[model samples]
Target: MKKTSILNKLRSSGLRPTKQRVEIAKLLFNRDKTFHFTVESLGKHLAKKTTTKFALATIYNTVHAFKKAGHLSEVHLRGKNNTTYFDTNISNHHHFYDSETSELIDINDNEIKFDKIPKAPNGKTIKNLEVIINLKN
Candidate 1:
């Protein structure tokens, strides 16, 4: 998407088109599609760019706010550090994690479908279904 269009989309989503937000949005909105990035990773990537400099806390706050605003989805990767990854694609789907390289790949929703959902015990309701397939090699 063009820069102007992206800025317009952000404004339409009720997000303030701040300098930091725009820079971060460009990184999140990739050319092909979805993107997976951690706060630290994103900060590091942004730091490399001389023009844009954002604090880690700012990144965290912006990301959380964006997620809450329904612009992004957060995924937690189970491991030693319990790292969190943000997904640009907001659609319902699964992920494939390469444990060896720690790479995250998106799995289309159509590839797998649940015909019947099991009964939820107690009063808990199923809000979202997350499937993380860990790949080992």
Candidate 2:
């Protein structure tokens, strides 16, 4: 993503285009494929690319803000460890998680099928649906 476009996106999202934020945005959107990262991992990657040492809280807050602004998606994991990962691809999809390698592979929405889906109770319908298939040896 170009600097101008990134700045526009931030502005549209009600985020100030600070130096650190601009740098972070560049690293995030200037890619050919979607990126999945945790706060710690993103901080480490940013440290290598730039001189400023971003605090964990800053990265955490920024990531959450981006998600709130609909720029990224959060993948909720339910397991013993329950580690959360952020994804740049916000479109509806599923994932295959390798427990041994701590890896998450994208599963397109068309790849899965459910023979029977339970009916929603009352007026509360299924707003969001996500499936995580855990992999094992």
Candidate 3:
């Protein structure tokens, strides 16, 4: 991502384009593909690849901020650790989680069909639906 575009995105997301945020955005949006990452793993990558150093708390804050801005999505799967994985793809979709390998594969939006949706409570509307299918070999 170019500097101008990154700055614009930060501004649009109501985030101040700080040095650390810029670097983090570059690390995130530089590629065309989507991915999932944890705060610890992202911090390690930044430490090895970039000259700039960011604290773990900084990474957490940036991740949450991006999620709030709709640039990232939270993924949940069945696991003992229950570690969090933030996905770069914010589009509507489902996931297939492999319990053996701990891999998450995106199920396209058209792949699944919802025959029936339970009615929401009064005065509330359904915002989104998340389906995670567990798989094992």
Off by over 4 Å in 2: 79-81
Backbone clashes for every candidate come to: 0, 0, 0
Q: lDDT for model 3, on a 0 to 1 scale?
A: 0.83
Q: What ranking emerges by lDDT with the best candidate at the front?
A: 3, 2, 1
RMSD of 1: 2.0
Candidate with maximal TM-score = 2
lDDT of each: 0.81, 0.82, 0.83
Candidate numbers, best TM-score first, in rank order: 2, 1, 3
Candidates 2 and 3 compared by TM-score, better number? 2
Tens digit of per-residue lDDT, candidate 1, span 12-131:
667788888888877776457788888888898777763877988879988887788687888766743578888888899899998787789999988878888888779998887888
Model 2 scores a TM of 0.89
lDDT for each residue of candidate 3 in 30-134, tens digit (9 for 90 to 100): 888778777877898899888997988888988888888888888865454577888888899889888787678888889999899899999999988889998
Q: Is candidate 1 or candidate 2 better by TM-score?
A: 2
State residue 66's C-alpha deviation in candidate 2, in Å: 0.4
Model 2, span 12-53: residue lDDT tens:
668898877887788887897888887777898999999887
